[model samples]
Target: MSSGLIDTKPLAGIALASAGYACFSMQDALVKWMIATYEVPQILFMRSLVIVVISGVLMRVRHHPSILKSPYRGTVVLRAALMLIAWLLYYNAARSLGLAELTTLYFSAPIITVFLSILVLKEAVGAGRWIACIGGFAGVVIAANPSHSPHLIPAAMCLVAGFCWAWSTILIRLVSRSESTLTQMFATSLLFGLACAVSFPWIWRTPDAEGWMLMIGLGLIATLGQFLLYEGFRYAPASALAPVEYTGLIWAFAYGYAIWAEIPAWNVFLGALLIVASSMVLVLWERRSEISARNRAAA
Candidate 1:
């Protein structure tokens, strides 16, 4: 019974992580569609308004009125700031880059997260995991193919966004150890909303009806994705949930091809395969190590 419970939690976490990635991919697609007609700041401002409302409702539902009362306010605020910058870079890149390519590049966040975990949390990574990280990075390089002349700027933006995302993920992992998920959500919405508002004066644009709907949808979807993502961490270790995030690549491919008629180059698929394989290997290694430790404890 205990073992069943143990297995269930991580499985649930993986499911949530996969679902979160899907939601995020959908949100990205919406952002890409809208960015063609609107500025990034306008989208950010409108979407952030939606997130603030949704997050507030979520906090109320959880009976946590004091959403800002987190022990790790500084860390949470910093994380939100990193995410805001990452979002700006990613949305800008999405304006020109194919979705599949941008996603593959951004998925490099997992590799960056692993290294950040070591540096920030002082977590020890085994040699095998280190090798897996290298493999994943190599895949990113292959997928990105900096040698490609025209994509240089967008690719650089994606890399920088991925690095910022990695830092944000590490902060989320750290803060989640002691902070409430609702608090985290609230902080993100509040801080990011404020940031967007400050930029709104400079880049404000009136949206059409269709644009408003898309902006609202983007915010709501992103809020749900953020909730599921943080909840996944609550249920499972970061190592266990990390690989499930690769599912976003599948969604990205579908959305790219269907919506924009954008098909990635062959090397993109090859690199994506490597990234996914390395991530899976890391997940399996962590699961095995966890089970082994549990068995040793029982013995």
Candidate 2:
């Protein structure tokens, strides 16, 4: 991700992404719970409406009554649309796919983001960062323990979802440069609500009291998740934070085990080690880069 220009606070960005991903993993869990009872559009419409109301109020209070018309308004809208597509593909696939399998396929997003960062954002990705990305995905594959005979269609959908998410990550970096966090967030939520509202009437199954709780809970979690993630792109380059997305796998497995009593295998331990090491590598790399820049400035 680039705000047209990437500043080099990789460590901070990584931290924010790490925290943000934990929230995302939780969001996925919440969606998985309601997918059986609710259509994607219904869930998204409700969730987005919550975010819109919350962010809109905060936007007015924090800034002004007027929406800050970003020059990247088009890009912001595109990002929001991409995320909606991602949720649709991902949640639909979740109906047929196991959690581990679904996440394994979607984990491809980081590598895609890294490549896209180099290609789209024109960021100088170091060999270390590439190694970190590879190592982290290797960890995810090990930890995921994807089924051997996963349905091809759902698997493909997961990959497409990952790609959509990767594209949105780039957009976050670009838009964050010009748009305030609240403005971009409000814009995204508003668009998401409107788009999902289209089919919401047709698919509407009135959420019962329990359903209402879960949906509102989903919206709150998503609001925090989106905020932290968008703020992350501000602190670090998209390429730099890409590997940190792998940390979500750690949270994902944790949630699975906690919720479903899925015991961890040997591979989980092995994979977690690699993922942690890969993060360390990125940290060291960023540290070195920062020092070098300082030295160059002094010289």
Candidate 3:
């Protein structure tokens, strides 16, 4: 494993992850709405189509000419498969779970991502990152305020979805070392789109004007979110960005309030404060680490 100055750019990764999560939270809100009327595969297929077009158009002529000829094809394919599984399971669970419950359950991902960063990538994770991830999780639980209802099946599906997504993120950091962002996006979205297409025909619901608008918006948002998040991984290790994932729950709450006029209670504010504070602490800690790393290099 080759790691260069990965220690110095944690803030960039954290910031990008924050923005990416906000977009994802919005995407979730849209999916939560669309799932009520359309099938999961259909929604994903549409989303993937937009991502594919954007990635394809933005890909440079100077980059690798063919996705098939890539040296990391196997790893990229595996990552794409995991992502497809993650979205499929997540959307299916969305059909039965409330957005709060869905976000709460998926919050388990940061822990999984950090653990994999340690075990798989052999990255040295600091106590500050660990503390942030744990604290942020506490905040998510408070903010989302999921029900204790034993909707066992959907709950289980959500946990699995989180794990798959977390693993795919690790793969993202792994490939970011060598893969072009556009190439990965193009390959992942292309493969993702094709996989979803297999079932798209069976579950197709002709979209009305509003539905078309929403799906197109979903695609554009997905592309931007993936680009930022993937670029973040290029600058910082996955473990450092793990805690940032919790911020999505905050966005989920905000979007919920905006879209449904659902007023969050006191717990939401408290959780938001903790989430923000944990992120700040991690940012300050990372700055210290980067300075120390630079001094050592200078020495």
Candidate 4:
């Protein structure tokens, strides 16, 4: 009974992580579907509004109203503003690039997160992980190939999105030290929604029936995706969740081909796989080292 219970924990974590990635993949597909018909600001506003409403209700019910309170109000506001920029840049990248390319570039988040944690959060990162980060970025270069004439705009947009995301990740880590993830998340949604709402007047056009459905789908899936991601983190260590996140690539490939008829090239796939594999190994290494250190201290 004890052995079975122990084995079950990791399995459950794996399932939760995979489910989270699936939800996120669906959200990306819905966003891509709407990009053709909806203005970026309109889509951002509606989707963020939906998330704020839903997450607010959840927080109220969970007796986690403190999630709305933050010790670092100014930092939280700046973080939310950065998130707004990140989302806008990311939406533009998705609009201009193929789904596969956008998704692949987004995976660079974990790598960026590590570097930011080391520099800003003062985490002790070793030399090996730094080498892995370098390799991961090299893979991004191979995948993006910005020097190529045709891929220039999308490539540049992806880089901007990545940089913005790196900043947001650093801000989130800082906020998480003093505030709940729920607080940070809800604040971000509220701020982003407001930004979107303000921009809507300038860019608003009435969405068609198809557009409405797509936007609704985008909001719903994104909300669910974020919920699952938070839940998975609650249940599992980050190392356990990292591998499952790669499943997003499979979903990206399927959705891109089925919906937009956009197929990734050989080099893109190779580079994406290299980055994912390296990141996963780095995560496993970190987790094992942590576990060993804990055991030694206990001993």
Candidate 5:
């Protein structure tokens, strides 16, 4: 029940963040598989159903009825809608894109988060953070290599998805000030599930046994990943946890290779290196800034 900004457990946050990204990587892989045969809305509806059930159970187990209530209901609904849009775009892109490539593009979220924080939260970002953000996007451009006409649509989708996700992250941080993590998760699940369900009449299709299992796995993994991510933010500053998300590149590459025999081009590796390094610089800078502020207060 610690608020996202007030908690100061960086190590635990990093660990949770890393684990959450790993789960997300896996979920993306499954979604990639499922989307080949199923509609995006269908996949979303089923996966969100699983999330609602699991998150509801967790809320009940925690015996926190407040987890079902939120003072910021409007923001919660907006965040959930943004998440749903982001997922739809990402998954649609995933259906055609290499996992690593898609992930590299989506990794733009952290950078976008920085700028959004500046604009929305009025968080004063230093020159170093700005440089890091520029460098990170430069890396994304290099990795994306959008010159290839065929990749343009999917790449653009990923970029927009990253933007939406960044906004969702900001909202989560804002709402976490007064909302329980469970409330955040539950509301997001319920809202997104309902949204997707509204499309079920047009998108619904019978799934084979294999499809059923994969869809269920997708739900479970995504729910857990999102929960862990929310918890990670609760334990540490988002900047400190940003770099840990780069670990998903490794998972994406591994899953891409193992599942689809897909290997990223050399530019992807290079771009990933730049992006990860830049993001880490921002994280380190933020950590130092936090330390300096604490010391100044103590003095």
Candidate 6:
């Protein structure tokens, strides 16, 4: 809303989201693999520490002079909290659920966002949007294949993570209205790094050489992934760009098989496809609705 100038320069949000998802999906696989040999606390601590250092340098060069002098503290906190919860859930999922399942569940963020905006932001929710939301959740049911057990712990965590992410999106919208994207991102990165560093002392465990490299890779991937995610939203609205969230399932599936030799069952693939298709349909529907509204206003 800070209008120096306004021009729609196309920077494919979907593509950026896809790339970020791949990086994230790969990072999950790598981190889980490391967890088998190293403690979770150690991995988290190192990852947080390394990302902080890496992001600090990047921010210094990109937006030197002062980082925190801006008005982005709230956005930073929201983004960090959302990301922290999502990672915690996804990491937990990595321990039990297959990558594809976890990725599919994570895509539920956009659907959750749709509803959250309705309740919190008081955004208009038309019949079409409602249909899409229902369709998306149905697809999730298919993907999750939830039985009576309620033992689908990872899926539940992913859902909780999605809720946090939706709130974070709200925070981002509020923050971006007044703050620079770079500033918000830098602050969030710095906060997360510091939080992890502070917690590292309690859960410190020495890792082997391989573990070190893995942690470094995890940190680099996470940093780049987050930066790209912010860039994605900068380019496109979440409704217009949200469907790309599903592509991570493909990446997750590929990594699961290629790296871990784990293959998803038929039901998993089917459910995942349903979720992806439903989310995409919702995205397209939202775009059409916006276009129609613009045309009406013009007329």
TM-score winner: 3
Clashing pairs in 6: none
lDDT tens readout by residue for model 3, 1-299: 22122435778888888898889889988988998888888888899899888878767544445667767789989998999889989888877887678878988999999999999999999999999999999998888787667389999999999999999999998877677778888899888889888985588899999999999999999988998888788778898899988888788878988999988899889989999988987898888998998899999
TM-score of each candidate structure, all chains considered together = 0.83, 0.94, 0.95, 0.77, 0.85, 0.78
Query: Pairing residues by index, what is the TM-score of model 6?
Result: 0.78
The pairs that clash in candidate 4 are none
**TM-score of predicted structure 4:** 0.77
lDDT of 6 at 174: 53
Give per-residue CA lDDT, model 4, range 2-95, as digits (tens).
1011211334554665676788777777766677777788988888877888877766776564543556777877877877777788888765
lDDT of 1 by residue, 21-100 (tens): 88998987888788778888777777777777877776677676363465677888899899998999988887678644
Off by over 4 Å in 3: 1-7, 60-64
Q: Whole-model Cα lDDT per candidate?
A: 0.74, 0.86, 0.86, 0.65, 0.77, 0.64
Listed per candidate, the RMSD to the true structure in angstroms reads 4.0, 2.4, 2.4, 5.5, 2.9, 3.9
CA displacement after TM-score superposition, residue 196 of candidate 1 (Å): 0.7
lDDT tens readout by residue for model 2, 1-299: 22233455767778888888999888888887898888999999888988888888887777633344567878978988899999899999988988678878999999999999988899999988999999999998887777676899999999999999999999988877767777778889899889998995589999899999999998999899888888888888888899999988888778878887877889888898899999999999989998998899999
Sliding window of 10 residues with minimal summed lDDT for model 4: 1-10
Residue 113: error of model 4 in Å? Answer: 2.9
* lDDT of candidate 6 at residue 46, scale 0 to 100: 69
